[model samples]
Target: MSAVMITRKVRKWEKLPGKNTFCCDGRVMMARQKGVFYLTLFLIVGTCSLFFAFECPYLAVHLSPTIPVFAIVLFLFVLAMLLRTSFSDPGVLPRALQEEATFIEMEIEAANGNVPAGQRPPPRIRNVQINNQIVKLKYCYTCKIFRPPRASHCSICDNCVDRFDHHCPWVGNCVGKRNYRYFYLFTLSLSLLTIYIFTFDIVHVVMRSVDNGFLNTLKETPGTVLEVLVCFFTLWSVVGLTGFHTYLLSLNQTTNEDIKGSWSGKNRVQNPYSHKNIIKNCCEVLCGPTYPSVLDRRGLTQEDLPVPVASAAPSSSSSSSSPVPQTTHAVLCLQKTKAPLIPNKRTPDDAKPSIAASAQKSPSPKEENPPAPKAPPLASPEMDVETSINKDKTH
Candidate 1:
């Protein structure tokens, strides 16, 4: 049989089997499923446009020339921060290679002392000390590696993310170690921007209302009413999230850990990752060195090197699951089960062997006074069947 076909497909981003969406040759990455992210973009752009066109021009003239300048700065900064949060990598850990996976399996085997074949395996959690505090790392079946500290498998992205905070659909990406700073700053800047737009919209109306009357001001600038409505509804959630993240930042806890009560629970557990000082915690999270993206999305994958996935011993890990088998093996069990068996061809001349065997087994009557019955010598099942067929033919 021919060997399994090895196809080379480009795009390291799409080459990954993880459940993520990649764009711009992996420049832009996001969860496969995004919620309200477009709505967020739409609301920000629409509200800003209305402010610039209707509110900003009037405010720039009467209120202050800096009003439009400051608003533009806020608008541009908010966009830059939002894109940084949404499009950037979220500190995803690459799936373990075969060598790494084998090494880990060996370590597991040494610790577990070999679980007998066909028996239930032990739980895949391992405990290690960090800052003198014990942290249990759970094995990810998908990634085929025990996650590092503060790493968790994101169900949405189907990738293990380091310092996983939460999968924010609003950002269409995971809030993780790499981009959490951007997300936090996005929220912070956005709250200020929202408040700024809201405040100025009212100010514009009041300044106009002094001469034109409040009801007339509302009617004249319809965009002001719309902007106020958008900002008013958006203000609480944006400000609320900013405050919440600020609190979380001070404690140096992730949204994931916070929700799970990792530190705040009645278990009296302390957060080992926390510096204990608020300023230090904030500085560590906000001003810490940024981690480079793990996705080599733009790299070219030469597929044939890794394509001989078929091995004598099949791996149960997800990465090697359903691997195409190789042609050579100690056993052809897979081939035997899957390929149709060839049938043996028989001719009428083939019956001669059975007749000859019967003749050899039956002694001539002339050679003995009485024909003696003799036991047959040991023979294979095929020989026995031939003898039976020969006897039936003679009878």
Candidate 2:
């Protein structure tokens, strides 16, 4: 197929309102809701942490004066990372680039004899084996393009993200190629903050118990009790998340890939992008150029590259007949035709007549006889006798 034909097909399939116009009604609402949720979490955590840091008598009397300042700095870092992750772009594919890719794919398909001239086939999933592991790449019918490796369509974001990790409600955004480093940093910082708070609370409570008694300290500082409980629970979650991401960084895998068992084969010794250096992998994920590095490794440069689009595997049938071409008229015809309803057994009188039978059985309106005209009513008996007398006198 020609490039023009392919472009027309892609445009026809997408049917978007305008070029690069994303419907913002639902997306805007979700973004606002997430913003509110993040703000609420920040306020709650910050207020509680600061309140305990300043008001707790144990800290005021025994802890170093710089502890509160350190706590404040950590809190600010957490907020900064959260904000950065939430607002940064998550490597959305450009509309122009996507169209170019579609055209290239069409040309490749034509060269391979998969699609005939001036016709487009329905997108199919292609299974590729890399590093002894099967990776299933899918074409996005909505976007009219094949998804890149390590990329996924986020239903929440309503876009395909490059190197997608997961949509985190806490951060209110996807942890993807652009912001993954910030996300990791945020997790790590939050974990450390939680650990620090938990330790400080425990130490303060112990000090109070030593000064007074265990039971008296509990009674005197009830706020400390609530703070300690909160820190203990939050510590577990943050620490667990930090540890999981650390492991993923070491393996150079995304959470999405890990969960989907993308690297679960026994023969898999290394990742496709692995330089066989753990330090290099970590640096690439944490400090190196984000989207460009990944795209470069996959041979998809900033400018379009001549990548071969793999055709779908042929069916097992030995027949060599050319495939039928799909047209708009055929699709409309299929939609116009309704499915036949099941026939039910019925009594002779209850049976409904078929269309042909009804046409033959019923009389035409013109052929049927019309009703007779009605006669006028007679006069009352006394009025009739009076009328007769008057008629005789007149005669």
The most accurate candidate by lDDT is: 1
Clashes in model 1: which pairs? none
How many steric overlaps does candidate 1 have? 0
**For candidate 2, lDDT tens digit of each residue in 268-379?**
5456756567898899899896554221111221322244455654665423455545796587765555323323333243443563355455545544678557688666
**Model 1: lDDT of residue 294:** 77
Q: What residue runs in model 2 are displaced by over 4 Å at the alpha carbon? A: 1-36, 47-60, 96-137, 266-269, 290-395
| Residue 367 in candidate 1, Cα distance off native in Å | 72
Global lDDT of model 2: 0.66
Model 2, position 91: C-alpha lDDT score:
65
RMSD of 2: 21.8
lDDT tens string, model 1, 81-101? 999999999999999988999
TM per candidate comes to: 0.73, 0.58
> Judged by TM-score, which candidate is best?
1
Range of the 10 consecutive residues with the lowest summed lDDT in candidate 2? 4-13
